[model samples]
Target chain A: MNTAAALSIGVFLFTYALIISERVHRTVAALFGAAVIVALKVVPWERLPEYLDLGTLLLLISMMIIVNIAKESGLFEYLAIKTAKLAKGSPMRVLILFSVVTAVVSSVLDNVTTVLLLTPMLLYITRLMGVNPVPYLLAEIFASNIGGTATLIGDPPNIMIASAAKLSFLEFLSNMGPIAAVDLVLTVGIIYLAYRGSITVSEGERRGIEAAIENLDENEVIRDRELFRKSVAVILGVIAFFFIHDRLELPPAVVAMAGASVLLIWSGVEPTEVLEKVEWTAIFFFAGLFIIVGALVETGVIDGVAQWLLGYVSDTGQALVIVTWFSAVASAIVDNIPLTAAMIPLIKAMGSSMNVYPLWWALSLGACLGGNGTAIGASANVVVIGIADREGIRITFLDFLKVGAVIMVLTVAAGMGILWLRYVGV
Target chain B: MSIFRSLIDRKFRSIAGDRYDEIVKRYREFLLLPEEFVLPEVESILIPLDRFSGDFHGVLDVLEAYRGAKVRLVYLLDAQTFRLIEETLGEEEAQKLLQVERERGKRLVEALKESLEGFGLEVQAEERFGDKGDDVIEMASEYDLLVISRSFGSEVTKTSPISPVVLKVVQHVLVPVIVY
Candidate 1:
């Protein structure tokens, strides 16, 4: 490699190290790296925006606005409380309901938002039910990542992949949906097996807690009934339109933005307030990370890495397995968003020899599922940990990895098996 | 007949005519209704919201007993605490932390309001920034009664079933206090 390629690798590794070490805010670390690259002329200043994926950025922002309105209306909380009531204070039932709802919600909304909205309410329910919230919270983190794999808007990595590959929303759902569906069920089963002992309550205690919660009128949390109704209608419409966006020749970002606008006008919420609620840290992080990844691409570092890795696998089947495990392990070690961003171009560089479509699926499955391996593996995991810390609940890294690593391995293995059978020979 | 009967026959018939039976029927129906379904004689209730402690259910039970009473829930945001957090974390971080507390307060008030509504009470939520105990005690005079929770805080003791704020409220408020 040349001097520029070596320097690029050094910059990338240092920035990544800072992010992983948690010594500085991940966003700040990424932005620092982006600044360094631009100052060093690794990537030209004027071409910075070209490196940033505006489609993914716009998609994230629009969806955040839409979901923020739903949250402000207390729709998600209302749904969660309803789910809890359905569980009737049984700890096992509570875990099931929460994981299912969180997974389902993450399929449409972003994982971090799904986890954020659910974590507080889950903690409260666990308190009322006399159970520890950590296990349920961990289950939710896993569910969110798994569920996110099923949809384009569910996770940052999926959005990046969709944006980069020019794949439609329907394409992602069609290819990734089946395995994600199976993985979600397997995830719930594994979590139940692992946490069932701690989540148990006596029959009488369960009934008492159930009776207490039955009195909570979920309707009471609705600040605006009219706004809630309007948001639901708009969201339904958005989902319906998402299915046909490709046929209609529209981008998913446009569809989401249109839905957001409709909600804004219908709900009469202040645009500024809704915007403030958006996770701008995530947005900036994506923007800066894209530029750094672009620098790696410009210097042929990704190509070199891709070519070197390809030297080990001769056939498509071997490539599929290798890519899945590599992505999974790498994603578990680092933030999946950055890992996926850096790998997308690398995968595209290998597009000439294999069916790029299956590789995309493999990467999507690995990166998304791998997030459950460690606390820092996914944004959702980090956010959930932060919420727990604020409540004086300390979830140690090893504590998460002990359970998460198992689920990650199981789901990633399940994903590889499914891909092998469906795309390759058994 | 007595003079009253004679007066009723002559004066009351002229005013009532044939509509008197319908009016009397309506009056009887009103009296036959359950007491809880009837509107309360009292005007409104004042609740001193201590951020840290309250049996939400018990408070609602008290409100249930006064069916149809208007409720005013006062949540005092302590400015001193906000300033302290600001000093330590700077403006943006402080605001974020305060925003979380504000959300918690709002949610608590809303939950109470909903429970009160379930009991047919008209509810109003008020947020003030000051010493919580002093504000609640001062504001208790505006309403007919003060209904506060007996559970003092997240951490409770038998010596203090009621929070210090509730204790101050009980000592100084002009209205009768109902400690749930």
Candidate 2:
């Protein structure tokens, strides 16, 4: 490698080490890396904008604003409470319904938000039922990753994949949805089986809890009828546009921003308040990441890495397996967002020389599913664990791994098989 | 395409240029109350509605002990629970619950007021939406003393004697807490 390549590679490794070590905030680490790259003139300062993925940033901001508005309108809590009511105090039903609901919501809104909305209400219901909420919380986390794996906008990794691969919303659904649906069912079932005999609520207690829930006025949850209607309308309109954005020759970012604008106009919520709710830390982190990754692309380091991987794979099936397992395992160790960001360029470089369409699906499945391996594997897991900790329910890494590791392995293995059959064999 | 690029480009630059920690700190500061308001003198006692057993008349013994101390009755509908209900049921239902909770608080206040008529103690009723523990803590600073009964909603129950929230409130607040 030449001087620029060596320097670029060194900076990239240093950034990754800092991020993985948790020594400094990720945003800080990423910013330092990006600043170093720019200062070194690896990519000219004027070309900084060219390097950043504007599409991804815009989509994230717009989505954040939309979700924040929905949150303010209390849409998420409404859904979770409605789903909890369906359980009617049965421990087994609570686990199943909550897991399924979490997964489905994660598919639409993002896993972290889903967990944030669900955990408190789930705990409340579980407490009322006189059951430990640990199992229910864990199942929700697992289901979130599984459910988010199915769609383009569900998980950060999938969003990165869509932006990088130019994949459409429908394409993501067609490729990964069926397998993710199956994984969610299996996940809920596994969680139920593991905790079924442990929950010892008596028939009398169950009936008592059920009666308490029946007395709860569900309609009392709505804080504002007009805002809820408006928020729901905007969200539904955004979803509809996501389906046909390609046909309209509109970018996903455009559709998202337009939806956000319409909501702002309709709701009359202050722009600053909406902007304050945006996850600027993640956005900034992504900006720095894109710069670093762009440096790698400019230096041909990604191509080198891609060539190294391609040399090992004899056929498409082996490539699919390797990518899926590699991504899954890597994602378990590090957060899937940055992992996906770094891998996108390499995957693209690999695809240029051969038909590697299946690899995208494999990467999506692995990165998202792998997030269930440990408490820190994904944003959703970490947030859920944090909430549990704050609420005086401690979940250690080993405690999470005992459940998460099993689910991660099973789901990833199944994902590889699905990719092999659907993409490669077909 | 260029206009879109420039617009996004401006955003990306700003995102990179901005300090997240500083922004978050500013936002946190913005969220805090502008300035602390001076609390009223500690001549009254504060009690949560649910803490009283057998409705408002349940605190008769404590009222008899205090003699001339005024009473402030607070009935809380958990803000988190209220928001959850509001989202699921609609505004109409949420309003009804608020009305119901308020009505319940008023009745409790009235009963206490009737019982304490000869004692020359003032009676006040309030319906709040939030964590009862937090509401109690915030109110504790202003009260001379808090007379409360341990209830099911308390984090520290008979089983878990040192409840997380109640204990924290006791530790943080300057006022004395008398648990019945």
Candidate 3:
């Protein structure tokens, strides 16, 4: 290899190491790496825009602001607790509800936040009801990973895929979304069968759970008469605009940012506060990541990787199978967002070599599914951890990793099978 | 048993990026007004709606003497004078301001109720809505003490120095007003 190539790889490796070690905040590390590459002139400023994709960043920000408002409504906790309350303290029933809700919410918003919001409530519920929460939390994380696969905005991997593939919102719904839905049902089924024995709750357990719910303070902001109506209108409009904006030649970025702006002004949020809540770190991570990935692409590294991987699999069908398994494995340790972003160009370059665009679907399925492999596999995991810690529940990384492995296996296998039968087998 | 104990004893930041410890420290001082007081028989206690914090159980522990007081929980909502929001703005902007006011009102009310149990005031919360001063003055004749909450709406903007309606309620009410 040449001096420049080795230097690029070295910088990337150092950044990844710092990220994994948690020695520095992720945003700072990402910004620092991006800045170094720019300062070193590894890639000139002119090539920067090619590396950056504003769609994913804008989508993330738009969703975060919307979700922040949604959270204030107390709907997440209220629903979870209300559902669990109906279970009458059955540990197994609670586990099922936790997983299902975690997945549903994770598919729409980030899974990390869903788990974070639910975990403490889970812990508190479990503690009060005299039951263990470990099983339920593990299941919740798994469902979150599986559920995140259903849409373009559901998880980072899907976003990376959407941006890289230039696929529209409808494309995902027509293809991998249904596949992910099936995989999720299977995951829930498998967990229920395995944990059925532990679910049996005595009457005493039922009463304990009832008492806990009775203790909840339900003075919800959902009662905000005017804001509630406006917030709902603004959110529904954002959703509608996301799907139809393509026809108007309005990019998803403009629609989302516009929706958020309207919601802020119309619903009475100060501009500064909304802007402050925007996670510039995640945005910077994308900006820097794009530049780094773009640099690699410019250097012909991506072409090399894509061509080799494509060459290794004779038919496009085989490549699909490989990418699915690849995503599941890689996602267990590293976050799927950056990983998926890193792979997009490579997939695009080599996608035509395949029998079809099957590899694109494979990559999407794998990256999203891989998030279930470990607690840190996606952004949602961190959110869950943070929320749980606030409520005094400690879900260790290793604890999540253990269940992550079981569900990751089931999902990867299911995805590969789906790819072969749908795109390859025929 | 050890795990349960640890969970109950746990301490962490409350709001994202807020110095919850400092807030707690400030609230502890506010709750201990008058410095010293003799024990009173358990009967009734007016939990001044706004002067409370997320430490209700601890507060209840201190006032254990009032074991069975039927607690009247009052939430003071600042009816938010609309001069700043209403001043010199287009009709669209004015409507938007009203939207924010209602959301701010609900968020504050919910947050207050959620954190109330920490004080262990066996409580019933009543939100006396409308502009804070006039509404609170009218209701002061009925309650033992008025709890003062930190202003729920935006800080009195430089554009409108209306001094907030909560202040007016504190001034006019014959009953003692608790402000945090």
Against the reference, the lDDT scores of all candidates come to 0.80, 0.78, 0.64
Model 3 chain B scores worst on lDDT over the 10 consecutive residues at B7-16
Q: Of the candidates numbered 1 and 3, which has the greater lDDT value?
A: 1
**Model 2: C-alpha RMSD to truth?**
15.5
lDDT of 3 by residue, A1-426 (tens): 565566667667777777666577666777788887788777788878777887778878888887666555555555665665665666766777777777777777776566656665666556655555556666776778777777777777777777667776667766876777777777777666756665556887577566656544443424355665676777778768768766777766677678777877777766676677666767887787787777677666777777777667787766676777877788777767667767788777785676547777888888888877766666555545545555556777666666667778887788778768877676
Comparing 1 and 2 by lDDT, which wins?
Answer: 1
Candidate 3: C-alpha lDDT: 0.64
Better of 2 and 3 by TM-score: 2
Writing each residue's lDDT as its tens digit, candidate 2 over B1-180 gives 344233323332333233223322322331222122234345778776543223444556656766677778777667886788889998889989888877766776677667776566777777777786778889877888776655524545467765455566677777767665
Listing every candidate in turn, what is its Cα RMSD in Å to the true structure after a full C-alpha superposition? 20.9, 15.5, 14.7
What are the DockQ scores of the candidates, in order?
A: 0.02, 0.03, 0.03
- Show the colliding residue pairs in model 1: none
Q: Give model 2's TM-score versus the native structure.
A: 0.73
> lDDT: which candidate is best?
1
**Residue-level lDDT tens digits of model 1 in B1-180:** 544234324333332233334323322331221233454457789875646756578556556878777888877677778888889888998899778878888888888888888888889888777876677777778888877776433345887666666676688988877787
Measured with C-alpha atoms, the lDDT of residue A218 in candidate 1 is: 83
Q: Write the per-residue lDDT of candidate 3 for residues B1-180, one digit (tens) a residue.
A: 344223222211211234223322322331221213333244554544432222244443444444445556555444444455456676678678667645654564455445544445465656554654565577666765554443422245466433355567666777755454
Query: Chain B alone: TM-score in each candidate?
Result: 0.68, 0.60, 0.45
Lowest summed-lDDT stretch of 10 residues in model 2 chain A?
Answer: A214-223
**Model 2 DockQ class:** incorrect
